[model samples]
Target: MTQTHIGVDISKDMLDIFDPRCGHRRIANTTAGIRRWLCGIGTDSFLVFEATSRCDKHLVAGAAAAKIPFVRINPLHGWHFAQSLNLPKTDRIDARMLARFGAERYPEPTLPADPARSDLAALSQRRDQLKRMETQEKNRLQDTSLAILQRDLRASLKALAVRITRIDALIRDHLRAHPQLAGQAKLLRSIPGIGPVTAVEMLAHLPQLGTVDRRSIASLGGLAPKARESGKFKGKRVLGPGRRHVRRCLYMAALAALRHPHLFGNAAARMRVAGKPGKVIVIAIARKIITIANAVLRDQTPFATA
Candidate 1:
């Protein structure tokens, strides 16, 4: 069978599809239509879609279930590609461009998380939302000197705290229900500064670490150092993108580990002697924590304090 590449331009009301060997087609962006079209494609074919707002959630899930190899490309990449090719501005034109783009360059496929992990992530996101809301409420109070709103705001903050507590409980319950995840959580907690909340967070963000090599997993987790260079201007290594969730937890872990006297105590002392700021040294500690976490997860072993 010929390897066929398909691209779909997603919009609220319609979907435009482009094929390299064949012409394009416009389909209703409904679930039934998406399923039928995806089901018609063979295993040797590939499907590419741009990540849009909420609607994309369905299209990607449908395509995955239909056994189509689906790739979610950064929309900006597609837009730049379109401009480079001098493609016109229209849904159909975008769709065709996507097809041609997919045929020429296929983006890496994303790994979909299990249902349990998905649920846990959702709860974690909700917890973030609550914290944001609490901050906003507090900021509003600070912005005004009105006493009437202050009382009401205090009540609201209390209610938000209660909701946050409930969400935390739900996250714990979900973790407890999965034995494999629960065991991983226990191992993560064994590390200094990795508490219950942070441990579960690492599990959610670094799930692939369990099956992959430590260095590769560390790079993917975004803890690996990136070299910086421009014609004649070379900069030192720096950390860039990785799972923000894991990175945040590592930031905290690094803080605790730096002062623990057993983890990075000597390294921290040398950095201080060299005039590196305490905070910067802590960040270096965080990077090391991420490396160690990758090793712990990949090897399924507890962190050795000694």
Candidate 2:
């Protein structure tokens, strides 16, 4: 039996769609609009679209509710696909290319986004923004000698600090409300490196941590080192692009992990003995932290030293 694939180029307000049989068209990226579009296509078809931040929320909800299978890919992946085909960049072309990519690649359908997890993710993002603002204010405070500017910066820092505290409380309450999230967080926090913030961030952002393989989770977390080698010329392996925020969380966790001599300190000591760079050691520890987190969640158990 022939399967239908539709590619969608999503913007904040509009969704550009392309189907092999139906050709190309545009629709409002709203609940009703997505519903009408999905209705026309039926359930047997596959919907392929990029993960355009919150813009794809309605589309994802619509597709999941309609029992339509979908694969939400990173924009970079789609761009690389276009480059491979030497295709021009346009909304219509993107939609068409997505359809073609779906038909040929046969990527698995992504799991539906849970509303509870979505709420947690939103909270986590807001907290991250607040922290960045706090950092900026602190930096400005350090550089400024003017009394008036310093006062304003200090005020901003205080306000941001209060907001962060409130958000932290909200996150705690959210975890209490969601048992599964709470359980996963508990397991994550059992590790020496993972703190409350890191646990919540992982639960909120990287939902596939426990579900996927270790290498895949590492790649998603941007911890996987990519080899740059061609014939005899073997360049140094470097990390590839992934969730920057996730990497940041893991980096901090890795720093904390170094304080534990039994769990991670020994590993760091070994790397130092080998004359590895400090940055390399930290990144290596960060990678190990994420892999350990992955294994813990996958096994539904806590990290144990013994």
Candidate 3:
């Protein structure tokens, strides 16, 4: 069966839609508008949209509820494709380009995860935001010489710290309430270097940890090194793009793992003996950690030191 291709350009207050069969139209970016748009499409229709922060949440929720197939393309990927077509920079043009790309590329549609996972993901993102805010305020405080400004910045930092603590407690409570997630967290934390923060981040961000193969898991975490080479010239292998939060958490875990002799320390020692650079060794360790974690989750077992 042929599927209808739809492209959507989402903004804060508006949604620009391009349907190959019906042409372009703009609508209010609201739940009602999204439901109205979904009502016009068939169940097999393939809707494509670029990731627009929180702007696409309503559309995604609506589409998921309506049982319509949809794929969220990366904005960077969409922009590069648009440039290849020499398309003018406009909402309508972008939407049309996205529709064409979806039709031609036939990317797999995303399936919605459990609603509880969504809540945990939101809480993880909020924790990251609070940390960033706290860091910025601390930096500003360092630069300011005025006593009054310093006091205000310190107060803001304290408030942010308290909020972060509260969110941390909330995340822990949520995980504890969900038995499966709590068990997974326990398995993850059983590793030598994996802590509560890293375990929660993995649970929240990487829902496919156990379901996917090793290569796919590494690629998703951006730990899989990509080889760069032409016909004759060979270049170094570099890590590709992936979930930044997951990668960051894994990298930190790798650092901590280096302190343990039995788990990651032995691996790092071998790499160091082989003359691998510090950063390179860390990346390798991160990849190893993720691969091991994936296997543990897949087998429904805790980490084993042997």
lDDT string for model 3 (1-306, tens) is 899889999999999999988899999999998999789778868899998788898999999899998999888999999989988999998889999999999998887878888899999999999999999999999999999999999999999999999999999899988989889999999887799989989999899999999999999999999999999989999899989999999999999999987878888999999999999999999999999999999999988887
The RMSD (Cα, Å) of candidate 2 is 1.2
**TM-score sort, best first:** 2, 3, 1
Clashing pairs in 3: none
Model 2 clash pairs?
none
lDDT of 2 by residue, 1-306 (tens): 667889999999999999898799999989999899888887779999998878998999999999989999888989999999999999999999999999999888899988999899999999999999999899999999999999999989999999999999999999999999999999999998899999988888898988888889989999888999999999999999888889999999999999997888999999999999998898999988888999999999999986
| Candidate 2, residue 183: how far the Cα is off, in Å | 1.3
Top candidate by TM-score: 2
The number of residue pairs in model 3 that clash at the backbone is: 0
Residue 129 displacement in candidate 1 (angstroms): 0.8
lDDT of 3: 0.92
CA shift of 87, model 3, Å: 2.0
